[model samples]
Target: MIRVLAFDVFGTVVDWRSSIIGELEQFGKSQGLQRDWGAFADSWRGGYVPAMNQVRRGELPWTRLDDLHRRILDELLREAGIQADEDDVDHLNRAWHRLAPWPDAVAGLHRLKERFTITTLSNGNVSLLTEMAKRAGLPWDCVLSAEIFGHYKPDPEAYLGCADIMDVAPDELMLVAAHPSDLRAARDAGLRTAYVDRPLEWGQPGRYRVPFEADEFDSIATDLLDLADKL
Candidate 1:
Protein backbone atom coordinates (compact mmCIF):
# COMPACT_ATOMS: atom_id res chain seq x y z
CA MET A 1 0.00 0.00 0.00
CA ILE A 2 1.17 3.50 -0.67
CA ARG A 3 1.79 5.53 2.46
CA VAL A 4 2.69 8.72 0.69
CA LEU A 5 1.36 10.16 -2.56
CA ALA A 6 3.82 12.69 -4.00
CA PHE A 7 2.69 14.97 -6.81
CA ASP A 8 4.17 17.02 -9.67
CA VAL A 9 2.67 20.37 -8.96
CA PHE A 10 2.87 22.54 -12.11
CA GLY A 11 0.66 20.55 -14.45
CA THR A 12 -0.53 17.71 -12.28
CA VAL A 13 -2.03 19.65 -9.41
CA VAL A 14 -2.25 23.19 -10.77
CA ASP A 15 -3.24 24.79 -14.06
CA TRP A 16 -0.18 26.90 -14.83
CA ARG A 17 -1.03 27.77 -18.43
CA SER A 18 -4.42 29.23 -17.72
CA SER A 19 -3.28 30.92 -14.57
CA ILE A 20 -0.27 32.52 -16.23
CA ILE A 21 -2.19 33.54 -19.30
CA GLY A 22 -4.87 35.14 -17.16
CA GLU A 23 -2.35 37.00 -15.08
CA LEU A 24 -0.47 38.22 -18.13
CA GLU A 25 -3.70 39.38 -19.72
CA GLN A 26 -4.64 41.39 -16.65
CA PHE A 27 -1.18 42.88 -16.42
CA GLY A 28 -1.20 43.86 -20.06
CA LYS A 29 -4.60 45.52 -19.73
CA SER A 30 -3.59 47.48 -16.66
CA GLN A 31 -0.40 48.67 -18.28
CA GLY A 32 -2.16 49.69 -21.49
CA LEU A 33 0.05 47.26 -23.32
CA GLN A 34 -1.23 45.53 -26.40
CA ARG A 35 0.12 42.04 -26.24
CA ASP A 36 -0.69 38.53 -27.21
CA TRP A 37 -0.86 37.33 -23.61
CA GLY A 38 -1.17 33.70 -24.56
CA ALA A 39 1.87 33.95 -26.80
CA PHE A 40 3.78 35.68 -24.05
CA ALA A 41 2.82 32.95 -21.63
CA ASP A 42 3.93 30.30 -24.09
CA SER A 43 7.19 32.07 -24.86
CA TRP A 44 8.01 32.49 -21.20
CA ARG A 45 7.23 28.82 -20.62
CA GLY A 46 9.48 27.79 -23.50
CA GLY A 47 12.52 28.48 -21.38
CA TYR A 48 11.57 26.26 -18.43
CA VAL A 49 12.67 22.85 -19.69
CA PRO A 50 15.95 23.96 -21.22
CA ALA A 51 16.81 25.91 -18.09
CA MET A 52 16.31 22.85 -15.92
CA ASN A 53 18.05 20.65 -18.46
CA GLN A 54 21.20 22.73 -18.12
CA VAL A 55 21.28 22.09 -14.39
CA ARG A 56 20.43 18.42 -14.88
CA ARG A 57 23.42 17.99 -17.19
CA GLY A 58 25.72 20.09 -14.96
CA GLU A 59 26.13 22.69 -17.70
CA LEU A 60 25.07 25.45 -15.35
CA PRO A 61 25.28 26.00 -11.65
CA TRP A 62 22.25 24.90 -9.63
CA THR A 63 19.45 27.44 -9.77
CA ARG A 64 16.07 27.65 -8.11
CA LEU A 65 12.86 27.59 -10.13
CA ASP A 66 11.97 31.17 -9.23
CA ASP A 67 15.28 32.45 -10.55
CA LEU A 68 14.97 30.38 -13.69
CA HIS A 69 11.52 31.83 -14.26
CA ARG A 70 12.76 35.35 -13.74
CA ARG A 71 15.61 34.86 -16.16
CA ILE A 72 13.16 33.69 -18.81
CA LEU A 73 10.66 36.43 -18.01
CA ASP A 74 13.21 39.16 -18.70
CA GLU A 75 14.11 37.72 -22.09
CA LEU A 76 10.48 37.02 -22.88
CA LEU A 77 9.42 40.61 -22.27
CA ARG A 78 12.23 42.00 -24.39
CA GLU A 79 11.37 39.62 -27.21
CA ALA A 80 7.73 40.65 -26.92
CA GLY A 81 8.53 44.38 -26.74
CA ILE A 82 6.57 44.67 -23.52
CA GLN A 83 7.85 46.92 -20.79
CA ALA A 84 7.02 47.09 -17.10
CA ASP A 85 8.33 48.99 -14.10
CA GLU A 86 10.47 47.34 -11.43
CA ASP A 87 7.58 46.63 -9.07
CA ASP A 88 5.51 45.17 -11.89
CA VAL A 89 8.42 43.09 -13.14
CA ASP A 90 8.94 41.74 -9.65
CA HIS A 91 5.23 40.96 -9.41
CA LEU A 92 5.31 39.32 -12.83
CA ASN A 93 8.27 37.20 -11.89
CA ARG A 94 6.21 35.90 -8.98
CA ALA A 95 3.24 34.92 -11.14
CA TRP A 96 4.03 31.28 -10.52
CA HIS A 97 2.97 31.87 -6.95
CA ARG A 98 -0.63 32.45 -8.02
CA LEU A 99 -1.16 29.40 -10.21
CA ALA A 100 -4.70 28.02 -9.91
CA PRO A 101 -5.58 24.40 -9.38
CA TRP A 102 -7.90 22.72 -11.80
CA PRO A 103 -11.56 22.82 -10.80
CA ASP A 104 -11.45 19.23 -9.49
CA ALA A 105 -7.96 19.47 -8.03
CA VAL A 106 -8.68 20.69 -4.51
CA ALA A 107 -11.68 18.42 -3.88
CA GLY A 108 -9.89 15.40 -5.28
CA LEU A 109 -6.75 16.10 -3.27
CA HIS A 110 -8.94 16.40 -0.19
CA ARG A 111 -10.39 12.97 -0.89
CA LEU A 112 -6.92 11.49 -1.36
CA LYS A 113 -5.72 13.08 1.86
CA GLU A 114 -8.17 10.90 3.76
CA ARG A 115 -6.14 7.90 2.59
CA PHE A 116 -2.52 9.02 2.19
CA THR A 117 -0.02 11.70 3.05
CA ILE A 118 -0.18 14.13 0.11
CA THR A 119 2.77 16.38 -0.61
CA THR A 120 4.46 18.10 -3.51
CA LEU A 121 7.57 16.82 -5.28
CA SER A 122 7.90 19.46 -7.92
CA ASN A 123 10.61 21.38 -9.75
CA GLY A 124 8.94 24.49 -8.37
CA ASN A 125 11.06 26.21 -5.75
CA VAL A 126 10.02 25.70 -2.11
CA SER A 127 8.79 29.22 -1.46
CA LEU A 128 6.96 29.28 -4.80
CA LEU A 129 5.24 25.99 -4.08
CA THR A 130 4.32 27.06 -0.56
CA GLU A 131 2.81 30.30 -1.79
CA MET A 132 0.89 28.49 -4.52
CA ALA A 133 -0.41 25.92 -2.05
CA LYS A 134 -1.69 28.69 0.20
CA ARG A 135 -3.13 30.73 -2.66
CA ALA A 136 -4.79 27.77 -4.35
CA GLY A 137 -5.72 25.77 -1.27
CA LEU A 138 -3.77 22.79 -2.60
CA PRO A 139 -4.07 20.81 0.70
CA TRP A 140 -0.51 19.60 0.63
CA ASP A 141 0.69 18.33 4.00
CA CYS A 142 4.04 19.83 3.00
CA VAL A 143 5.76 21.07 -0.15
CA LEU A 144 8.93 19.58 -1.61
CA SER A 145 10.82 21.06 -4.52
CA ALA A 146 13.84 20.93 -6.78
CA GLU A 147 15.10 23.73 -4.59
CA ILE A 148 15.33 21.24 -1.72
CA PHE A 149 17.02 18.52 -3.75
CA GLY A 150 18.92 20.77 -6.13
CA HIS A 151 17.58 18.60 -8.92
CA TYR A 152 14.65 18.45 -11.33
CA LYS A 153 12.13 15.76 -12.23
CA PRO A 154 13.01 12.97 -14.68
CA ASP A 155 16.15 12.64 -12.61
CA PRO A 156 16.24 9.44 -10.57
CA GLU A 157 17.55 11.36 -7.59
CA ALA A 158 14.53 13.64 -7.58
CA TYR A 159 12.06 10.75 -7.78
CA LEU A 160 13.69 8.39 -5.31
CA GLY A 161 14.55 11.34 -3.15
CA CYS A 162 10.93 11.63 -2.08
CA ALA A 163 10.86 8.09 -0.73
CA ASP A 164 14.02 8.80 1.22
CA ILE A 165 12.53 11.95 2.69
CA MET A 166 9.29 10.19 3.63
CA ASP A 167 11.29 7.33 5.19
CA VAL A 168 9.51 4.67 3.19
CA ALA A 169 10.54 1.98 0.79
CA PRO A 170 10.26 3.09 -2.81
CA ASP A 171 7.38 0.73 -3.51
CA GLU A 172 5.44 2.26 -0.65
CA LEU A 173 5.52 5.64 -2.37
CA MET A 174 3.36 6.48 -5.35
CA LEU A 175 4.34 9.32 -7.70
CA VAL A 176 1.28 10.93 -9.16
CA ALA A 177 1.87 12.99 -12.27
CA ALA A 178 0.40 13.96 -15.64
CA HIS A 179 3.80 13.79 -17.30
CA PRO A 180 4.93 10.34 -18.39
CA SER A 181 8.62 11.19 -18.17
CA ASP A 182 8.25 12.16 -14.52
CA LEU A 183 6.26 9.00 -13.74
CA ARG A 184 8.67 6.84 -15.67
CA ALA A 185 11.54 8.23 -13.64
CA ALA A 186 9.62 7.35 -10.49
CA ARG A 187 9.01 3.78 -11.68
CA ASP A 188 12.69 3.33 -12.52
CA ALA A 189 13.50 4.54 -9.02
CA GLY A 190 11.26 1.74 -7.63
CA LEU A 191 8.14 3.70 -6.76
CA ARG A 192 4.62 2.77 -7.80
CA THR A 193 3.11 5.01 -10.44
CA ALA A 194 -0.21 6.66 -11.20
CA TYR A 195 -0.84 8.74 -14.34
CA VAL A 196 -3.58 11.25 -13.83
CA ASP A 197 -4.70 12.81 -17.10
CA ARG A 198 -4.63 16.58 -17.43
CA PRO A 199 -5.80 17.11 -20.99
CA LEU A 200 -5.77 20.86 -20.76
CA GLU A 201 -2.42 21.17 -19.11
CA TRP A 202 -0.73 22.73 -22.11
CA GLY A 203 -3.77 24.84 -22.98
CA GLN A 204 -3.89 23.54 -26.51
CA PRO A 205 -7.55 22.72 -25.86
CA GLY A 206 -8.45 19.30 -27.30
CA ARG A 207 -5.07 18.93 -28.96
CA TYR A 208 -4.33 15.84 -26.92
CA ARG A 209 -5.90 12.66 -28.15
CA VAL A 210 -4.40 10.64 -25.31
CA PRO A 211 -1.82 11.22 -22.59
CA PHE A 212 -0.67 7.67 -21.73
CA GLU A 213 3.10 7.31 -21.39
CA ALA A 214 3.67 3.58 -20.85
CA ASP A 215 1.95 0.43 -19.63
CA GLU A 216 4.26 0.08 -16.63
CA PHE A 217 2.30 2.24 -14.21
CA ASP A 218 0.19 0.40 -11.67
CA SER A 219 -2.85 2.51 -12.37
CA ILE A 220 -4.21 5.42 -14.38
CA ALA A 221 -6.94 7.88 -13.50
CA THR A 222 -8.70 10.86 -15.00
CA ASP A 223 -8.05 12.95 -11.92
CA LEU A 224 -6.94 12.77 -8.32
CA LEU A 225 -10.46 11.88 -7.21
CA ASP A 226 -10.41 8.87 -9.50
CA LEU A 227 -6.94 7.91 -8.31
CA ALA A 228 -8.09 8.20 -4.70
CA ASP A 229 -11.07 5.97 -5.45
CA LYS A 230 -8.77 3.43 -7.04
CA LEU A 231 -6.52 3.32 -3.98
Candidate 2:
Protein backbone atom coordinates (compact mmCIF):
# COMPACT_ATOMS: atom_id res chain seq x y z
CA MET A 1 0.00 0.00 0.00
CA ILE A 2 1.14 3.56 -0.65
CA ARG A 3 1.66 5.12 2.73
CA VAL A 4 2.79 8.47 1.45
CA LEU A 5 2.00 10.57 -1.60
CA ALA A 6 4.85 12.91 -2.44
CA PHE A 7 4.05 15.59 -4.99
CA ASP A 8 6.13 17.70 -7.38
CA VAL A 9 5.09 21.27 -6.70
CA PHE A 10 5.84 23.75 -9.47
CA GLY A 11 4.09 22.39 -12.54
CA THR A 12 2.47 19.40 -10.95
CA VAL A 13 0.48 21.16 -8.26
CA VAL A 14 0.75 24.79 -9.17
CA ASP A 15 0.60 26.51 -12.54
CA TRP A 16 3.94 28.26 -12.49
CA ARG A 17 3.83 29.65 -16.02
CA SER A 18 0.44 31.27 -15.60
CA SER A 19 1.24 32.41 -12.08
CA ILE A 20 4.56 33.91 -13.12
CA ILE A 21 3.02 35.55 -16.16
CA GLY A 22 0.27 37.05 -14.00
CA GLU A 23 2.84 38.57 -11.67
CA LEU A 24 4.92 39.81 -14.57
CA GLU A 25 1.87 41.42 -16.15
CA GLN A 26 1.03 43.21 -12.91
CA PHE A 27 4.59 44.43 -12.49
CA GLY A 28 4.80 45.54 -16.09
CA LYS A 29 1.56 47.46 -15.84
CA SER A 30 2.76 49.13 -12.65
CA GLN A 31 5.96 50.22 -14.36
CA GLY A 32 4.30 51.15 -17.68
CA LEU A 33 6.30 48.49 -19.49
CA GLN A 34 4.75 46.07 -21.92
CA ARG A 35 6.41 42.95 -23.22
CA ASP A 36 5.54 39.35 -23.97
CA TRP A 37 5.58 38.21 -20.34
CA GLY A 38 4.68 34.70 -21.44
CA ALA A 39 7.89 34.53 -23.40
CA PHE A 40 9.63 36.19 -20.50
CA ALA A 41 8.29 33.55 -18.08
CA ASP A 42 9.39 30.82 -20.44
CA SER A 43 12.85 32.33 -20.73
CA TRP A 44 13.17 32.57 -16.96
CA ARG A 45 12.15 28.93 -16.53
CA GLY A 46 14.58 27.86 -19.28
CA GLY A 47 17.42 28.79 -16.95
CA TYR A 48 16.23 26.51 -14.14
CA VAL A 49 17.75 23.20 -15.22
CA PRO A 50 21.10 24.63 -16.32
CA ALA A 51 21.43 26.53 -13.06
CA MET A 52 20.71 23.42 -11.00
CA ASN A 53 23.09 21.39 -13.17
CA GLN A 54 25.86 23.87 -12.39
CA VAL A 55 25.47 23.14 -8.69
CA ARG A 56 24.94 19.44 -9.30
CA ARG A 57 28.21 19.26 -11.26
CA GLY A 58 30.05 20.97 -8.36
CA GLU A 59 30.92 23.98 -10.48
CA LEU A 60 28.88 26.16 -8.13
CA PRO A 61 27.94 25.93 -4.50
CA TRP A 62 24.57 24.57 -3.46
CA THR A 63 22.11 27.43 -3.90
CA ARG A 64 18.43 27.60 -3.04
CA LEU A 65 15.79 27.98 -5.74
CA ASP A 66 15.10 31.52 -4.50
CA ASP A 67 18.66 32.58 -5.25
CA LEU A 68 18.64 30.78 -8.57
CA HIS A 69 15.41 32.50 -9.57
CA ARG A 70 16.82 35.88 -8.64
CA ARG A 71 20.01 35.21 -10.54
CA ILE A 72 18.04 34.17 -13.58
CA LEU A 73 15.74 37.17 -13.25
CA ASP A 74 18.73 39.51 -13.26
CA GLU A 75 20.26 37.81 -16.26
CA LEU A 76 16.93 37.88 -18.11
CA LEU A 77 16.40 41.55 -17.39
CA ARG A 78 19.89 42.31 -18.68
CA GLU A 79 19.41 40.25 -21.79
CA ALA A 80 16.01 41.75 -22.55
CA GLY A 81 17.25 45.29 -21.90
CA ILE A 82 14.54 45.73 -19.27
CA GLN A 83 15.46 48.51 -16.84
CA ALA A 84 14.49 48.29 -13.23
CA ASP A 85 15.88 49.37 -9.89
CA GLU A 86 17.16 46.89 -7.33
CA ASP A 87 13.93 47.10 -5.37
CA ASP A 88 11.88 46.34 -8.46
CA VAL A 89 14.10 43.45 -9.40
CA ASP A 90 13.99 41.98 -5.91
CA HIS A 91 10.21 42.26 -5.70
CA LEU A 92 9.77 40.76 -9.12
CA ASN A 93 12.10 37.90 -8.27
CA ARG A 94 9.83 36.95 -5.37
CA ALA A 95 6.91 36.17 -7.67
CA TRP A 96 7.72 32.50 -7.33
CA HIS A 97 6.58 32.62 -3.73
CA ARG A 98 3.17 33.84 -4.83
CA LEU A 99 2.33 31.21 -7.41
CA ALA A 100 -1.28 29.96 -7.57
CA PRO A 101 -2.23 26.31 -7.47
CA TRP A 102 -3.90 24.50 -10.32
CA PRO A 103 -7.70 24.21 -10.28
CA ASP A 104 -7.64 20.62 -9.06
CA ALA A 105 -4.62 20.81 -6.78
CA VAL A 106 -6.14 21.71 -3.44
CA ALA A 107 -9.27 19.60 -3.83
CA GLY A 108 -7.42 16.58 -5.21
CA LEU A 109 -4.74 16.77 -2.55
CA HIS A 110 -7.36 16.99 0.15
CA ARG A 111 -9.00 13.86 -1.19
CA LEU A 112 -5.72 11.99 -1.44
CA LYS A 113 -4.61 13.16 1.99
CA GLU A 114 -7.63 11.50 3.55
CA ARG A 115 -6.01 8.14 2.78
CA PHE A 116 -2.29 8.87 2.62
CA THR A 117 0.36 11.18 4.01
CA ILE A 118 0.72 13.96 1.48
CA THR A 119 3.84 16.10 1.29
CA THR A 120 5.95 18.01 -1.16
CA LEU A 121 9.06 16.57 -2.79
CA SER A 122 10.18 19.47 -4.88
CA ASN A 123 13.42 21.07 -6.03
CA GLY A 124 12.31 24.40 -4.53
CA ASN A 125 13.93 25.67 -1.35
CA VAL A 126 12.11 25.12 1.93
CA SER A 127 11.41 28.78 2.58
CA LEU A 128 10.24 29.30 -0.98
CA LEU A 129 7.99 26.27 -0.92
CA THR A 130 6.65 27.16 2.52
CA GLU A 131 5.79 30.66 1.40
CA MET A 132 4.22 29.30 -1.74
CA ALA A 133 2.13 26.80 0.20
CA LYS A 134 0.85 29.51 2.46
CA ARG A 135 0.10 31.84 -0.42
CA ALA A 136 -1.55 29.13 -2.48
CA GLY A 137 -3.32 27.48 0.45
CA LEU A 138 -1.68 24.14 -0.27
CA PRO A 139 -2.47 21.63 2.44
CA TRP A 140 0.76 19.70 2.54
CA ASP A 141 1.30 17.61 5.65
CA CYS A 142 5.02 18.33 5.29
CA VAL A 143 7.00 20.39 2.83
CA LEU A 144 10.14 18.63 1.67
CA SER A 145 12.61 20.14 -0.74
CA ALA A 146 16.02 19.75 -2.40
CA GLU A 147 17.49 22.03 0.25
CA ILE A 148 17.19 19.20 2.74
CA PHE A 149 18.86 16.64 0.47
CA GLY A 150 21.39 19.01 -1.17
CA HIS A 151 20.39 17.59 -4.53
CA TYR A 152 17.74 18.30 -7.15
CA LYS A 153 15.14 15.99 -8.63
CA PRO A 154 16.34 13.09 -10.82
CA ASP A 155 19.17 12.88 -8.26
CA PRO A 156 18.95 9.60 -6.35
CA GLU A 157 19.41 11.42 -3.07
CA ALA A 158 16.35 13.66 -3.50
CA TYR A 159 14.07 10.72 -4.25
CA LEU A 160 15.45 8.38 -1.61
CA GLY A 161 15.74 11.17 0.91
CA CYS A 162 11.99 11.77 0.83
CA ALA A 163 11.29 8.13 1.60
CA ASP A 164 13.88 8.31 4.38
CA ILE A 165 12.33 11.43 5.85
CA MET A 166 8.95 9.72 5.95
CA ASP A 167 10.54 6.64 7.50
CA VAL A 168 9.10 4.42 4.80
CA ALA A 169 10.54 1.98 2.33
CA PRO A 170 10.76 3.37 -1.17
CA ASP A 171 8.02 1.02 -2.34
CA GLU A 172 5.67 2.46 0.26
CA LEU A 173 6.05 5.88 -1.27
CA MET A 174 4.35 7.00 -4.46
CA LEU A 175 5.72 9.99 -6.34
CA VAL A 176 3.06 11.99 -8.17
CA ALA A 177 4.59 14.29 -10.72
CA ALA A 178 3.89 15.95 -14.07
CA HIS A 179 7.34 15.27 -15.45
CA PRO A 180 8.15 11.78 -16.67
CA SER A 181 11.83 12.22 -15.85
CA ASP A 182 10.89 12.93 -12.24
CA LEU A 183 8.64 9.88 -12.11
CA ARG A 184 11.33 7.77 -13.76
CA ALA A 185 13.87 8.86 -11.17
CA ALA A 186 11.57 8.01 -8.27
CA ARG A 187 10.75 4.68 -9.91
CA ASP A 188 14.44 3.98 -10.29
CA ALA A 189 14.75 4.67 -6.58
CA GLY A 190 12.11 1.98 -5.97
CA LEU A 191 9.09 4.18 -5.39
CA ARG A 192 5.74 3.79 -7.13
CA THR A 193 5.11 6.47 -9.74
CA ALA A 194 1.95 8.30 -10.80
CA TYR A 195 1.99 10.71 -13.67
CA VAL A 196 -0.38 13.66 -13.52
CA ASP A 197 -0.94 15.04 -17.00
CA ARG A 198 -0.36 18.78 -16.92
CA PRO A 199 -1.04 19.68 -20.50
CA LEU A 200 -0.26 23.37 -20.13
CA GLU A 201 2.68 23.17 -17.79
CA TRP A 202 4.74 25.24 -20.19
CA GLY A 203 1.90 27.65 -21.15
CA GLN A 204 1.61 26.17 -24.66
CA PRO A 205 -0.47 23.33 -26.03
CA GLY A 206 2.39 21.35 -27.53
CA ARG A 207 4.94 21.89 -24.79
CA TYR A 208 3.81 19.00 -22.60
CA ARG A 209 3.32 15.42 -23.74
CA VAL A 210 2.28 12.31 -21.87
CA PRO A 211 4.32 9.20 -22.51
CA PHE A 212 2.56 6.75 -24.83
CA GLU A 213 3.75 3.63 -23.08
CA ALA A 214 1.35 2.31 -20.46
CA ASP A 215 4.25 0.96 -18.48
CA GLU A 216 5.94 4.31 -18.14
CA PHE A 217 4.24 4.92 -14.81
CA ASP A 218 2.39 2.76 -12.35
CA SER A 219 -0.60 5.01 -12.88
CA ILE A 220 -1.39 7.87 -15.20
CA ALA A 221 -4.26 10.34 -14.87
CA THR A 222 -5.50 13.44 -16.56
CA ASP A 223 -5.03 15.51 -13.41
CA LEU A 224 -4.49 15.24 -9.72
CA LEU A 225 -8.18 14.69 -9.07
CA ASP A 226 -8.14 11.85 -11.54
CA LEU A 227 -5.08 10.45 -9.84
CA ALA A 228 -6.87 10.64 -6.54
CA ASP A 229 -9.80 8.76 -8.06
CA LYS A 230 -7.48 6.09 -9.44
CA LEU A 231 -5.88 5.66 -6.07
TM for every model, in the order presented, reads 0.95, 0.97
lDDT of 2 by residue, 110-143 (tens): 9999999999999999988999999888999999
Clashing pairs in 1: none
Error of 1 at 199 (Å): 0.8
- What are the root-mean-square deviations of the candidates from the true structure over C-alphas? 1.5, 1.1
Q: Each candidate: how many clashes?
A: 0, 0
Off by over 4 Å in 1: 206-214
Highest-scoring model, lDDT: 2
lDDT of 1 by residue, 1-231 (tens): 889999988888888899999888888888998777877887888899998899999998999988899999998888778788989988988999999998889999999998899889999989999889888888998788877777788888887778888899999999999888888889999999999888888777545435564576899999988887888
Instruction: State each model's CA lDDT, in order.
Output: 0.87, 0.91
